[model samples]
Target: MSRRRRKALPSEPVRCVIETLSHDGRGIARDNGKAQFVDGALPGETVMAKFTSTRSKFDELRAVEVLEADDARMTPPCDFADLCGGCSLQHMSGESQIRFKEDTLREHFAHFGGIEPDEWVAPMRSPALGYRRKARLGVKYVPARESVLVGFREKRNSFLTDIDRCVVLDPRIGDRITPLRELLHGMDAYRRIPQVEVACGDDSAAMIFRNMDPLSDSDRQSLIDFGQAHDLHIYLQPKGPDTVHRIWPETGEERLSYDMEEFDLTMKFHPMDFTQVNVDINRNMVHRAVEWLDIQPGERVLDLFCGLGNFTLPLARSAGQVVGVEGDDAMVVRGRENAELNGLSNVAFHGADLQADFTAQPWAAEGFDKILIDPPRSGAQEVCEYLTAFGAKRIVYVSCNPATLARDAGVMVRNGYRLVRAGVMDMFPHTTHVESMAMFERVDN
Candidate 1:
């Protein structure tokens, strides 16, 4: 006789109270013998969830019903919250979101780094909505529907959502959604254009259409005329990010820039460049990081993963010497130019990949008294290691991902660094995205 196969365990639906939210917007719920991460649930409420995926220790759950609702859960401000995949925590109160993010950083510090801040960190909060300054709007022409949907992706799906407006986007772009949809509906290359890049500044807003095929002169003229009427700078991209160009009136090399009064800095960037979506949070973050670093006069400071001198120029105000290192050569060049434009002679920028081994760089030869690092979602693991090698007295780290930051902070702790303080910055409000900053110091021998 053939051996019989074991029976599969059946998943059971259970009601659990959501005590807190994870950084990625999942609700922390514990089930029988498993840690369940449930989506579409809020803290302080009981939810009926079905286990979707189970592991040995952790499980993923989909909220089937809200057995009890949290008072903190309010109606989402955005119309596309249920459909659009862009933001997850819009229904959660802004104050509650900030609190959750702060606790996230604190928990990371205590659990992974084996350290905690002596003083409570002041949370960095910004406008609750309409703060996104940079975004890529997805475009799709549904032949069956005889219309185009130009917005963000759908919830839990790769298909584009049918959106008339996006509340989290800047008012200029958010208000133009309907007109944009109509504009594309009448365009000859409507099917060819798959994306529209949005970049906004204090004085201007730009939209760049990414098309697979070249537009006719008449179509181009139509786009230009429409853009002029709407007071938008129109650009076209037939290929990669480098191919994006102004398709309308010729502006040779005019780039957009945002000014920070606290830093006394105005930095310029290209349309297809990396930038913080929220200008207000960016300013507050710079001020907070500078305060935490406490750059004294005649002190040597190092800024890692510095993009266009966001932190370097401000740091130069007090430090005798400030060096910025970035992976992008274009950004490094722009960083230098911004420093010169601001008349900051103390800051110097170098182009080097901080994600790799940057210890061999000549700039690493000079000892830095304090270090400021703002890394992308990948987090600055290698850069943190490099900084530890130099034995920098103080280290201030800014991270968009809490999990990776916790992992990197563990490395710092293992190397004799103590987590001094950490806080959350609400850079992207109405979303589950968490932006955080932490300060560390070498333990005294």
Candidate 2:
């Protein structure tokens, strides 16, 4: 059923001041026992919201009027702010977004986990706009509309929004939206194109177009010409991720790479490779995680879900030996290749499901002095338990979701690990999305 068509009991609109932002980018407002989550609102703002959906314990509302906007609020630079689903905190300034994330982490630590950091860690931030280097764009071919949509979903709707440009994406890729849409619309495979996977390196941009059918010769030529004209590296995926092939004019353009000077690392990645969207903030986060780990010259470290050795390779610079484990075999292979390319023979990578039983692995039994985890939103609950056997004295966790992190922290606490320090990293700016880093240490023997 369409979201708009879903039957929701209507309730009276209420005037309320948004107390704060929830971890999932919603604003919290309380009315008696029924909690209301107002979308498109900010903390400290007086607004009127009309309830659209209701439940026994909570209600979902949409802001109808801003009686008094928060001082920190500003007009979003993107014209598609309200319509496009790319960003949730566009109304809030970049700096304010960081502050909001910091507050959210602090609140979660105090209330949910019954923990607090002894000192305030600097909030990691990147450029306000044009920082997102990775994204999966939704593609919709509207026959009636005589157009192909290539952008994010509309706010609260599954339908793709018709966007000409995006300010949050790296300028090179952001400026190509219109061209991409027009190119697809003109192709014989127009309706067949369903997705555009974007990956940006420090100097190059790569996009993979997912198609339902093989492209015609003219279509292929047109795609190559378009890529050449725009100086973009293009790939085509006829089926699965492994089938993706470069379609650009130059063979050299097939490779997209990014440089991380802090770790002295440069990595070559395909368009579908997993990487942090915001490069600037990622550098800071990795540096901070390494510092918190307090890695020594000869300590052994384990990096969990260590995609492309983002943390593992950097840790190798300080640790005598580093082991990186990831669920994806392809990513694990890439990480190993990256380590070799960087001449870091101290790092080893294993392709295993961290969420699954790891008692059989020799690395799992081997003791590590420290551990770092950068898990997905699902959190690393299973891996947290696995670490107990590894005998790591300290652990640093980098999380994108606070609730999951808090839940994982609960597990660690039960297993004799105490959350010694935690703070927010504003990897994404002008969005309610919170990126946080935390350190947990086992109780002294």
Give me the candidate number with maximum TM-score: 2
Lowest summed lDDT across 10 adjacent residues in model 1 is found at 5-14
In candidate 2, list every pair of residues with a backbone clash: none
lDDT of 1 by residue, 139-249 (tens): 999989999998999766789988898888999999889999998989898889999999987777889999899898877988898788888888999898788889655
lDDT of 2 by residue, 1-445 (tens): 6466666566666897788777767778888756789888888888888877777788888887889888888888999887677888888777777777887777776676686655667777667889999999988898789889999998777999889999999988899899889988899988888899888988878788888998899998998888788778888899988898987855554567888788788887767888899988888888888999999889999898998898998899999999999999989988988898899999999998788878578876767899999899989888887778776889999999987888788788888887888888777777778889989888873
Off by over 4 Å in 1: 1-23, 28-38, 46-67
C-alpha TM-score for every candidate: 0.90, 0.91
lDDT of 2: 0.84
List, in order, the clash count of every candidate structure. Answer: 0, 0
Query: All models: lDDT?
Result: 0.84, 0.84
Off by over 4 Å in 2: 1-20, 28-36, 48-59, 111-113, 249-254
